[model samples]
Every structure is written in C-alpha cells, then in structure tokens.
Target: MKDAEKLAAFCATIADERKADNIVQLKLADISTVTDFFILCTANSEPHLRAIADTIVRDAREKLKVRPRKVDGKPASHWIIIDYTNVLIHIMTNEMRELYQLESLWGDAPTVSAIKTLRKKTPA
Candidate 1:
C-alpha cells in the first residue's frame, strides 16, 4: 500500500482502539485533490472525541513520525478534522455524522478496506 493508504489504515485502527463507531475510509485520490483518503469515525461524546484525537496524533507522531499539517474543529464541537496532507480524518458525534451524511455525499468514492487486516499486522 502507498504510504497515504497505510496512514489512513493506521488512523482507522487508532479510532477503533478508542472505541470510535462506524469507522470508514473513503479513497478520494481519483475524485478529489483535497486529500487522498478520508478516515472517518463517530465518537460517543466530547471526551471520547478528544481521546481518539489525542491518541491518533500521539501514535502517528511516535510510531510513524507523522503529524497532521492542520487540525480543524474542537473536541466539544463534536466534529473534528485532522488533515495530514495525504490523509484527512473526521471524528464526529453520531448526530453530526448523520447530519453531514458524508458517505452519501461521496457516493462515488470507493470505500477502502484492509484496515482491520493492517491493524492485525502492525503493533500498537
């Protein structure tokens, strides 16, 4: 896998570890210039959102020597976005996720799998 795709899978695994719900990765390379992959998951609450965000940042930096170029939205906002140039992560509350309906909005984008498999191969 490309580094971006591997990073996406890593972020997805981090979300899963933090108990984020409905995790999904949308491959946007063919359709968008904004980013390569969108790793999205739903957080249960403000604290949960913060925890997931923190873990991703810390783990990515420590494990992969990677960091997001920019991070948008606050933990309390219930919808935070972490942009890593090649990959973008969306951590949202259930309500915000439902409201945005990103999956439908990006219906043409293909969902990327193998994250679960990747998680198994990589150490935490």
Candidate 2:
C-alpha cells in the first residue's frame, strides 16, 4: 500500500485498540490540499481521548517510526487533531463529532470501509 493508506490504516488500528467508536477514513487527496486522508473516531470521554491519542503517538514512534508534524486540541477538549502531513487524525467526543460533522463536510471524498474488514482479508 501507499504511504497515505498505510498511515491511515495504522492510525485507525491505534484508535480501535483504544476502543474508539465510529472510526471512518476519508480519501481527501483528490479534493483537498490539507491531507490525503482523514481518520476520524469518537471517544467516550476525556480520558478515553487521552488513551487514544497517547497510544497513537507512542505506537507510531516506537513501531512505525512516524510522528505527527503537529497536534492540536487537548484531552480536555472535545476534539483532538494529530497531523502527520499526509494523514490527519481526529479524535472527538460524540457531541463534538456531531457538531462538526466532518464526514458530512467531506461527503464528496470516498469513504474507506471498516479497518477490521481490511485486516480480515490480510493473512496474519
């Protein structure tokens, strides 16, 4: 897979490991300049957001050798954004996700199916 797809899939796995809900990956390369993909997931609370964000950082650094160019928002906030240049990750509470409706905003971008489906197709 390409770097963008690899990065997005990796991030999605990290989010799933942390019990993030409604994970969605959007292919934004064709339509946006900001990033190639957006990995969005919903967290249950601030601590849950922290767990997801912290593990993404730790695992990406220790395992993937990749780090976010920039990170925005905080665990206390409703949303947290991790920017990896080619891929962007958003972890948010249900309320914030509903308010922003990023999936709706980027409706034109093609949506990648659940990561679990992708994992299942690949042999362990």
Candidate 3:
C-alpha cells in the first residue's frame, strides 16, 4: 500500500481502538486537491472525541513516525480535524457528524476499507 493509505489505515486502527463509531476512510484524491484521503469517525461524547483524536495523533506519531501538520476544532466544539498533509482525520460527536454530513458532501469519493487494511497489516 502507498504511504498515505498506510497512514489512513493506521489512524483508523487507532480510532477503532478508542471505540470510535462509524469509522470511514474516503478516497478524495480524484475529487479534491486539499487532501488524498479523509478518515472520519463519530465519538460518543466530548471526552470520547478528545480521546479518539489524541490517540490517533499520538499513536500515529509514535508508531508510524508521522504527525499531523495541523489540528483544528476542539472537543468542546464536538469536532476535531487533524491534518496530516495528505490525509485528514475528523473526529466528531454524533450530533456534529450529523450536522456536517461530510460523507454526503464527499459522496462522489470512494470509500476505502481502512479497518480491513489495518487487520491485514496486524499480526494475529
């Protein structure tokens, strides 16, 4: 897999470990110039949102040697956006996620099986 794909999968895995809901990785390379992939997931609450975002950032840096170039939003806002140059991670509460509906906004972009990719890379 490509570096960005691997990073996306790795971020998804970290989010899953934090019990993030509705995890999705969207391939935006063909449709958008802003980023290549977008990893979006819903958190149960503000603390959950913080945990998911923090874990993704921390683990991605420690394990993959990658850190987001920027992080936007906050737990209190019910949304957090971590920008890793080629991949963007969105951690949001259900309400925020519903309101934004990023999936619908990027409907034309294809979804990638990020969890499956992580599982394949992980040893049982």
Candidate 4:
C-alpha cells in the first residue's frame, strides 16, 4: 500500500479501537485534489468523538510517525476533521453524519474497504 493508504488504514483501525461506528474510507485520488483519501466514521457522543479523534492523532503520531498537518471542526460541533494532507479523517456524530451525508456528497468516489486494508497489512 502507498504511505497514505497505510496511514488511512491505521487511522481507521485506531478509530475502531475507540469503538467508533460505521467506519469508512473513501478513495478520492481521481476525483479530488483536496486529499487522496477520506476516512469517515460516526462517534456516539461528544466524548466518544473526542476520544476517537484524540486516539487517532496520538496513535498515528506515535505509531506511524506522522501527524496531521491541520485539524478542523470540534466535538461540540458534532464533527472533527484531522487533516493529514493526503488523508482526511472525519469523525462525526450520527446526526451530523446523516445530515451531511458525505457518503452521498462524494458518491463518485470509490469506497475503500477498511477491513480489507487492515487484513492485507496484518501478518499471518
């Protein structure tokens, strides 16, 4: 996998560890210049959103040796975006996710199966 793909998968894994819901990774390389990939997931509440975002930032930095170039949004806003340049992590509350419908907004972008990526990177 490319470095960005690996990073996205790792962030998704970290979010999963925090019990984030409906984790998704969108491939936007061909469709958008904003980023190569987008990792979207739903957090149950403000605290859950904070925990997932914090863990992703902490683990990605500590384990992957990378940090987000910038972060936007906030837990109180029901969304948090961790921008890694090539991969943007979107952590949102269920309501916000449903309201914004990022999945549909970027409907043209293909979805990358986070579970499949994780399995391929894992050793037997």
lDDT of 3 at 37: 94
Residues 25-123 of candidate 1: C-alpha lDDT, one tens digit per residue: 999999998889998888888998999999999999999999899989998789999999999899999899999998898888999863332122357
Model 3 accuracy (lDDT, Cα): 0.87
Model 4 / residue 35 / CA error / Å: 0.5
Return the lDDT, model 3, position 5.
Answer: 90
Q: How many clashing residue pairs are found in candidate 4?
A: 0
lDDT of 4: 0.88
lDDT of 4 by residue, 4-38 (tens): 99998889888888888788899999999899999
Stretches of candidate 2 above 4 Å error?
115-124
Residue 82 displacement in candidate 4 (angstroms): 0.3
TM-score, model 3 to reference:
0.89
Candidate 2 TM-score versus the reference: 0.89
